[model samples]
Target: MPWKHADMVRWLHPQHLIRSGMDALVASIFGVRADHRLIVAVGRPQPPYFDYSDEAAGEDFWLDYVADTGDGWNSTYAVARLLAKPSLELKDPNGDTHALERGRILVFGGDQVYPGASRDTYEERLAQPYREAMSRSPDPSPHLFAIPGNHDWYDGLAAFMRLFCADRWFAGRRTRQSRSYFALKLPRGWWLVGTDVQLNSDIDVPQLEYFRQTATYMQPGDRIILCNAEPAWIHAATTPHPRGYMENNLEYLQEKVFGRRISLFLAGDLHHYKRHEDAEGRQKITAGGGGAFMHPTHAPRALRLRDGCEQKKCFPDEKTSRELTRQNLMLIRHSPFFGLLTGALYLILALSAYTELGSHGLLNIHEALRQLAASLVNRPMSLVVGAATLGGLVGFADPAFGRWRVPMGLVHGLAHIACAFLVAWGAMYFTVSTLGICAEPPSPKLAAFIIPGANACAGGWTHMWAKFLLGTFLTFAGGFLVGPFVMGLYLTVSLNNFGAHSNEAFISLAIPDWKNFLRLRIDPEGQLTVYPVGLERVPRKWKATHADRYSPAYDPDDPQATDPILIEPPVRVMPREQAP
Candidate 1:
């Protein structure tokens, strides 16, 4: 049987629904955190981005967006270099030498690879690269650990289990995890707790029980560094967005498991770096810049409410937001992929128009526009317009909207609707302008060319129009649904694997080459410091030189040409008790 687009959509619909339902279930079950003794720490370390085999196979149609070879400064080479010299030299507040050991346990927040979880892709993209890195390095390997992110769960966790839970080895690194979630007892009363937040902050029964059992051994004043795949708190801090799912999950974990003992909470998924401190002095850091498309740090205008969803007053204002916006601009100017995607979409739309307009020159562009306009005069269109207007009004109802322009559900929904309408209109115009004007009756061969199965069809003019309208409607609806609003959100919200795999409509979004990772170090005196390392220094002409494209891998032999540099000074975190 031949595969149909509708069939593929049907198959994928339930799979996505299942994942969503599972997230809801997990959130319900572990909705509230429960108390327990400290359990024995499980030592398991895994690499980042679960899949990257696109190039290893034939040229993948989509995986190129997320695949990385680590040959360049951003992938395993830079990270491996850091691991080679596994410790950093620092100074205490008193100016004394403070030696910080690069963690013996390497915790991967999540997203081991891209375009879904498969062992082959993992081996090609993750393990071998790290193995190569370790082979070249002089330092002993650290115990690798990981927590499953959404990408890992996309394939039903099969690849994730095989790679991490089944004692698989990536180069010299071994996966020691018995399950996805684990507790690690570190030195100096420090504990690393990594949780799986696959769907809606959900934890499976066994994993929850494991943590519950693990909590029994906890001592008072014990500090925790919580690791999760999604940056829920940062998301929650956004205003007028469904206020607190992530915050609730974190609260659950903090109140029940550690009892406010969490010193620092770390999360990935967003391919950028950000840090936030709340009124309670709880530190939430997003260090996901781990070799995926770089996320823009610019504070997005709240799509829902005024004062834009900044809970804890954490969103950076004008002056500080520029840095992120600058990076975003650089990506836009440098990457040519987005432009290619847009052009491709237009071409496809034009060809599809040809199929309908070529054989039967019956439909006139002007008449279609007239009919469309006349149709919109009906009640349905009015209601749609009215509803959209109402939504916008309610969204901007918040007094802060006057100053901040935060968007709400109504606003976002209206934007989508508006985008759909505009797209439908534009599609019609472009189709008619190109195909309608030159449309002519097709010859026998031309007819066959226009419709692949034309010979099998037994139909008159009515039948031709029937097929044309049906096909055109479906095509137009699809283009309308995934229109500008959806594309804009991909950039603004930074969701859906940072638009990896060409899931997004336009090519305006550019993936950067700065590959990043974090080293979580605990000093002899128990102070926790984090060092964010990029594979190479972001080139000075990055904006100009990388305007067209950036390389994923660098020369392995000339590793020193782009040695990993610490992007910022070491951040010394205050212990949980001292945070306030």
Candidate 2:
């Protein structure tokens, strides 16, 4: 059948009936909006840990299947582990919360839940946390804008929609629905676009369309904020060689699209804080530290920052000027108790070895006895080697063990060398001298050298020679030389792991991801500084007497002087556009 132009247009129309139906369903599910200043709070929601095996319905078929057999427990535990810490206190130490109230819109960056959504999963992980937050609010609340995270769509988003968007209608107009990729036009002439970058979608098309639409609506000097769950800027900053479509989209937006106007890109997911300005001048801020887990604290690389010191030469850069910072509440440590336990376990093994061998006077025996034992019962030698190897590995496994700071590479290298030497010596000795053999007298070419003959005598001598040389070398080396070497290796690995683990735990607890809290403040010029809650306050002098000032000594109970503190005129310029 030949297609007509009208038919082709219909076929290639921007809208699809099924897609529209789904959009309508989603709009109905989540009340969609396109007219307001947007504020977003990105975070990882915590879930409660449950003990399934100990429940009352232990025998029930469903319960047994879910919990008793350990499958359900494993799955639940995996998610619960991610959500164990829920409170991402993003509030600054100085106490500021007004910025949140001032913003007309709010967006959740990503990782709303540790694991993506399933029926009970959403209820257990997200709904409860959201409900608790809402309950604390004095009123119904501000409009929330959110996008799906990888975890939110774990089970194809069936449960997420049901919980977050199922029953909401569009503002005023009941029939006009919302879609995930909708935009909100704010009174401030700012357009907030929320995007979904799940597994099955392309971010380029919607983003380009958004840019085109934004250009149509936005005039010169207007601000356009694009929000995604992942920070495209940071991704590009960290990934020198970006491979996939997402990276390509990021490059295009950075290089071609966002240079003209005031555009801010925000993202979460790294569980750390990072801000980057590309060479072309665009700001990319990563506020992924919304309370799930603290990621390794990272300093901006010299190439990543314009004014930062060289990464290798500088131990720590100017702390105040870093665009990326780590903020956290609790500082947990690998309980010294674990180190004590590990030490005690090593002591016990060492003592057992001493008792077993020392009691037999093996330690004091002639070196020949050690050699005889090596050839007869290789178990003791094997056991000693095995124990030393295991101990060394355990030390390497954790860095909090003790003063020992051994590199695993060195230990592994030495062990391989020792094994190789022993094997070579053994093969040569055994092959030459084990079986008695008489070699032929040397010819003119080689003076007095004996060559192997095919007779039994030649083979016997070859075997005996091999056995003698190999056995003697191994006996001496394995007994006296390898023991101390193994012990040193063990100590090194143990100490390194112990120290490293302790340092890791402490840093994790001390510096949390700041993306979780709603950072809100009003500058003197009435400009809002909306940022991650827990960011360290940039040191600045407070105006001695400002219009919004109250007596510093005023009591908390006094109502007359309880006005919110406001900074005076000459607002601090927050760089609107960051360098790409």
Candidate 3:
């Protein structure tokens, strides 16, 4: 589709050479200037801390005003949530006011407030601060291309759209409507595609479709900047399951639209800085640390590189000792909550198992412990004991035993119940012990044992203990139930197989000479053979006929490049009849 104005077409179709040429043609036709500077600002503004702070009283007070003064707007694009405090100030480095001339700066990303976009939230957290910052600026007017983040969508973005896009309707129409995604064409050779990546199901549908259509207008050598609230590339890495829309669309853009073009991606949901580069040299920058609650740290696969490395550092914060300390504390606190829940579940399961086994004859708690320990040392031996216990329980409940069987049944049931209870207790014991170990402050001696220059060892040790304990509990429980049943079933099946196969030659043959399952062979006669359940010789044409005069064969492992002509056949193209 052709744009009404030449500048508009250039801004919209930076990737399309034909469209760009048409823009030049239209500009000449309309006689308008097409050159302008473009800049982008993206940020997320919310309270910096997750929880309240008492020790930060003085710091908090200073931050309150610092937030109000709009000091965070150090960059060109004040792309931030208004609630992030300290709105972006458009000013000179020397503290001089600078008027935002037309086509100078653009605010390209983020929601203005967090959570539900209540009118109160907009006024208190966003509108008021934004107004104050604008008034303070020397030149209060600048074109802004703001997009809503998830929080803005909390209340369906009623207040946000009204506040930002009120003046410019969709397609410059007079009718009022709200949109979370839009495309902008700057006066310069720049095209900006802003998308809302809120968790809504519709984000991938309409938004991605629009982005693809918008890219059709772009030309080669023109810069296209894609702005989204969530770093789509990070989601690609972290999401355990595949969503075809995001994966396919991203692949299409990277291969087709962005091929050999200077394209940039901007996003802000992570609340921290992240830069990811792929094998193909594509880059994604996540500048989520605008002013929201910092996300808890987790082990990231990508490592930070040295300053001069070809691979850019993914996370600079992870390398800092202070950041590591904070991360360790967060990890310790997060893991135990799940551990506690699992322990409670196991306890309940243990009680149920105890009830079931108590009706059998095996009710001795002490005996059960002995059997458990013995089972660990010897596998089938434990199975024998477990089967006896089960049979005894069944016998005790049999009518032939009468009154005596009642007591026997009770004993057996109690014994089984005890075993089940013990399983949960054992799991909980280890879980609690590990938590205690982690909870205890590291001693000076223990600290010395840990790696020097590393953060606290408690987090690592706690994680290890939790995994070990959980694994042990699961193994014990699974073996207890399945071991006896599997052993008996296998014996029954084997006996049946033997009886059915009873014949003159009942014995199975064993090939002791054939050590490995399969062996490779090359015959001196130039035939290659494979021997296994059956023997087959390779076709004569497929066999290697020539060998190096100096060596037995071409050794790929040799520390030298192979002769290209020797290894590869020369290509010769002739008339179709002479192709062979």
* Residues forming the 10-long window of minimal summed lDDT in candidate 1: 59-68
Give lDDT for model 1: 0.47
Where does model 3 exceed 4 Å of error? 1-103, 132-136, 168-178, 200-213, 244-262, 278-282, 296-298, 303-311, 314-316, 321-580
Ranking by TM-score: 1, 2, 3
Provide the lDDT at 137 for model 2.
Answer: 23
Model 3 lDDT per residue over 293-401, tens place: 2332222232332211122332223333123223222221322222333233334334222221111123455654564455335455334544555565555353323
* lDDT over C-alpha atoms for residue 398 of model 2: 43
> Over 4 Å off in model 2, which ranges?
1-102, 136-141, 167-178, 199-215, 243-247, 254-259, 276-282, 299-528, 535-580
Best by TM-score: 1
User: What's the lDDT for all of these models?
Assistant: 0.47, 0.35, 0.35
Q: Which portions of model 1 show Cα errors greater than 4 Å? A: 1-77, 84-102, 136-140, 239-250, 278-282, 300-510, 535-563, 576-580
Q: Report how far off residue 257 is in candidate 3 (Å).
A: 5.6
Residue 337, candidate 3: Cα error in Å is: 15
Listed in order, each prediction's TM-score against the native is 0.57, 0.44, 0.37
lDDT for position 34 in model 1: 30
Q: What would the per-residue lDDT of candidate 2 be over residues 111-221, giving only the tens digit for each residue? A: 565423456544444433233223222222234445666556455555545444443421211111133344555433344455666532335454455555545655555
